[model samples]
Target: MKQGIHPDYHPVVFMDTTTGFKFLSGSTKSSQETVEWEDGNSYPLIRMEITSDSHPFYTGRQKFTQADGRVDRFNKKYGFTNKD
Candidate 1:
């Protein structure tokens, strides 16, 4: 609650690269990029690699680690005796 003690919470735009989706929001995070929003205003742009807009989990296409042939290879390399 002191002056100059808290970081600035200003307008920011998060851009999704994979989906090319952008939205206007506010945050304390800092960035050097500037972008003109759809409302005809400019704000600091924060480029994000992943978000709900283009995430595999939200899209229901998530991929998991392949455990079928990996277990045999791991056991052969490290001599794991436990099979169960």
Candidate 2:
């Protein structure tokens, strides 16, 4: 590994804005914000809009699309209707 060419990798705290969940992980990304973690040490804080904690898929809150309505619209456009 080259010494001066590589970016500094250090512990970073990722905070979910919605759920307020925080986790520490190593990253090359830098931040002007700092947060004191559970270990009583400060690390660079990164704010995220969505994380596994607040994501729809991970939280099992996924919304179902109305494909049936779309199919009806497509048929109507082509002058076709459902047989049954």
Candidate 3:
């Protein structure tokens, strides 16, 4: 590990804008905003548009489309059967 060459890694808060969910994590990114965490310590605040808390997939609001495969659809359309 080289010294003075690595980016500064520090604790920061990531907040989901939509859900207002916040979590503490380490990041090299910096911001002018600051927040006091539950641990009674202040860390840099980073605002995010989306996170696991508000994401459709993570929130169980994601839609799964079961589309037929191209080959299967083509075979079915032409009435083709596998000989093997």
Best first by lDDT, ranked = 2, 3, 1
lDDT of candidate 1 over 27-66, digit per residue (tens):
9997888999988998999998888887888988653444
**Candidate 3 TM-score over all chains jointly:** 0.69
Q: Which regions in candidate 3 have their CA more than 4 angstroms from the true location?
A: 62-84
Cα-based lDDT for every prediction: 0.85, 0.90, 0.88
lDDT of 1 at 45: 93
Q: After superposition, how far is residue 60 of candidate 3 from its true place, in Å?
A: 1.3
Sort by TM-score, top down from the best: 3, 2, 1
Give the top-scoring candidate (TM-score): 3
- What TM-score, computed on C-alpha atoms, does each candidate reach? 0.67, 0.68, 0.69
Clashes within 3 Å, all models in order: 0, 0, 0
Model 3: per-residue Cα lDDT over 1-84, one tens digit each: 888999999999999987799999999999999999999999999999989997778888853332346668888999998999
Query: How well does model 1 score by local distance difference test?
Result: 0.85
Which clashing pairs does model 3 show? none
Runs in model 1 deviating more than 4 A are 63-84
What does candidate 1 score on TM?
Answer: 0.67
What is candidate 2's lDDT per residue for 1-84, written digit by digit as tens?
667998888999999998899999999998999999999999999999999997888998853355577878899899996678
Clashing pairs in 1: none
Which of 1 and 2 is ahead in lDDT? 2
20 in model 3: Cα distance from truth in Å?
0.5
